[model samples]
Target: MPFFLRTMMKVLRVPKRTIFIVVIAFVLGSASIAYAIEPTTFHTWFNALYWVMTTMATVGYGDYFAKTVRGKIFTLFIYVFGIGLLSLVIGKIIDLLSTVYKHWEAGKLNFHGKDHIILINWSKKAQYAIEEILSFSPSSHIVVIDESDKHPVTDRQEIHFISGDPSSEEILEKAMLKQAKAVIIFADTRIDEPALADGKTLLIASSIERLHPAIHTTVEITQEKNTKNFRHVHVNDFVLSYDAVSRLAVRAALQQGSSEIINQLIRREVGDDIYEIPVRPEWKTYKDAFQGALEYGATLLSDRGDLGINRKLNDPIPEDARLFVVSDEQTYRRLLAI
Candidate 1:
């Protein structure tokens, strides 16, 4: 064994896998330059590089070739050593890629983006949430973090995955919690009991709040009873999964088209979706707010934040009012601009 190769093997402890890559790169590069020196149809360095790539991919176009005896001899040399070595290098590189993909799907990789939403659990609901986010805010980045050994999203793009307990500071920091826009913690539906699932969800919410109380956290509680416990944390929104669904089902049973109406109100994929925008300064009362909403072609539904939703049209709008309008994303943005 060469001294450097032996030393590298001892130091890196990966055998010839790493050494072959470096050695093949150096050898192939040097050989191509030496063979392309004179009139061998390769006039420029770029042409020489093109020949090497085409030859490696087994796509010899014959646009460049060996004309002289010396160059022909070098071509023979290339077939024997160059092609074989290139094949080995390619195989090893592909193996490395497959290994990386496996790790990524297994939730072994850590997230590295900023201002992204972090999802704490993986379920069918998580998949739906991902699809909805992609539909509504296509530009937003999402990182799905789960403690389970299985990865939820491997084939998906524009979304990242991290496998670790969300409550741990190491994992939270890995997900870039300090730079996160929001953390959506989902209940463990596999737990079979709402309280048990909500308990675990609350624990994660508390851990996140403790790390950065300023972080906007939306938690899914399995049971309505768990809402009181979430008050301990600075959770910005709560999804009463079971309770809300059940109530919706009841309403749907009582009123015709109630389920479809409710679905349309919050649906993101098609039709008008619910949007929240700041009530501009000119909108001092509900009447003005309605007029402002009409100008933007959005129906004013409710007010959020330091304001009540079910108010008369003549009622005064609160200073810290956020209006929820029923319209497309463009209309909502237009209303905000007003």
Candidate 2:
């Protein structure tokens, strides 16, 4: 059975008293005819039941008749009482059906499983972030939790959306927080109070941490100063939108193609881009990955352990590190000559 139907059945299950009343009414109404008519006429219980059904349905055929005066009176009671009971049953069924349908609609957007990203708050930037994540991992499942009535993205099976306050434990539980890989809280664009948005975000992060300490968390902040307050929450990453934009503007002023390069790096498309590959212990140094990248139409950017190559890179490939060019699997295989 469908979940909605099962729930409705549980809710609308007839009470013992109601069942007893209905049974009594049906039996009394049917037996009332016995007071006026002879039992010998119907010949069997099956025939009497058939007569009762036809009479209650108002589909009387002249084949069966109640000739006695008492039978006429019993027929009158059946006509009035039978119609009312039938209507009540129909109304209850309709009510149960409507309840089931509403639950079914809600169930469609419920999330499940672990290692999924949960995005709190809906905004243009959040939408862009989701698009970027999808571009890299096309099969990744995203659960969006927001208070908005409609989701910005078109309904796809891979994307689950729930409308509720992110700070609420009930809502977070519905988003499958325990199994989530990461939670990203977007700064609410409508709210002018940066503190309020950050508070909510922090509360959600704290709740997740309390429930599942190992889950990764990232939060977007409008003010750079508020970033310090979130340190205790053990947030994996924090994005100061205003500061980042200002820095980007400064860079764009000096470099003409800076913004384009950043865009291409974020979006997965045909381009030479930076990507992270897990280090294989057999590959002793970054130089091995560099030689591997030369064959694969890619460059070994840097090694995860090389602290010296953190941000400053004068050349495309860094020295003494292991970073592989990440493109399609075919390109990676061909480059490795595998």
Candidate 3:
């Protein structure tokens, strides 16, 4: 039993070695056993190998036959021992594949996805975020990595997983970090301490930035205090979950239906969503942009760019200026053209 367990472990751990051993054993065992009957049944080593392969595979072609009494006795042992060993080796391969699959599902395997979205850190938030993205684009490739023992999301073959610290370059590389369309790093909300959780998220964002400086990244910050710290990483966007919730809670306590209204605004099923578009040719001037927003039924939120924000709307909109507008998907697209 102990020897069997050790062999199983070796086969599972080092399948290449097990395959080499099995192939070598099959050649030597078949050559020794079948060569004895070669003089009667098979004329040469090549014919002996053909007979052994066919017989062991249980495809008994009648082209070869044992003529002598000694050959017949040896044939009995060949059928029993050769077929049994070959079956055991084939069974080992199947078992190894199953074991590898389980490991892969558990996120022990390296990632191979490209042009996919990567979600760093596992949490209820991560799961929801992934689901939200997939709801709109179900075919979008997504890879999730976390330090947790087991993946929170499963039964999703489309969602590849890497179970490890996201800050590790080795682990990040497995997810095809450089080739990813975008990465969203969520604070590990499982950790009781909010600071520690946000800190980890910050580190993961910085690590991703270092891995590929131009890779677009979005990170969820759980602590209001750490908001400024993430700016150093040059993250493209921040979720600011803790601060947003706290402000919403304060508004709800002071006013009527504030929380419900805020929730409705951000909810996926809500009437409208926030979208951003670059300033258009007709909307080059601030007054034109402002009038265009009103004409198109889009609520103009802000005019911004990578290096600066122009909330005043008094000056002319620059060529690189982007406008944040709140409107339905259909209206938003029309507003961009108008």
Instruction: Identify the candidate with maximal TM-score.
Output: 1
Number of backbone collisions per candidate: 0, 4, 0
Angstrom error at residue 159, model 2:
2.2
- The 0-to-1 C-alpha lDDT of every candidate, in the order given, reads 0.78, 0.71, 0.78
Q: Model 2, stretches more than 4 Å misplaced? A: 1-110, 149-154, 270-272, 304-307, 310-338
Q: On residues 25-127, what C-alpha lDDT tens digit does candidate 1 reach at each position?
A: 7566844664555434676766777666666566899988777777767666667766666776666678779988888877777777788988888899888
Residue 88 of model 1 has an lDDT of 63
> Judged by TM-score relative to the true structure, which candidate is superior, 2 or 3?
3
Q: After superposition, how far is residue 243 of candidate 2 from its true place, in Å?
A: 2.0
Which residue pairs does candidate 3 place in steric collision? none
For model 3, residues 40-141, the per-residue Cα lDDT tens digits are 557677787787777777898889866677777767777886776677677777887998888877888877767899998877888888877886578999
Which pairs clash in model 1?
none
**TM-score, per-candidate, Cα-based:** 0.79, 0.62, 0.69
Better candidate by TM-score, 1 or 3: 1
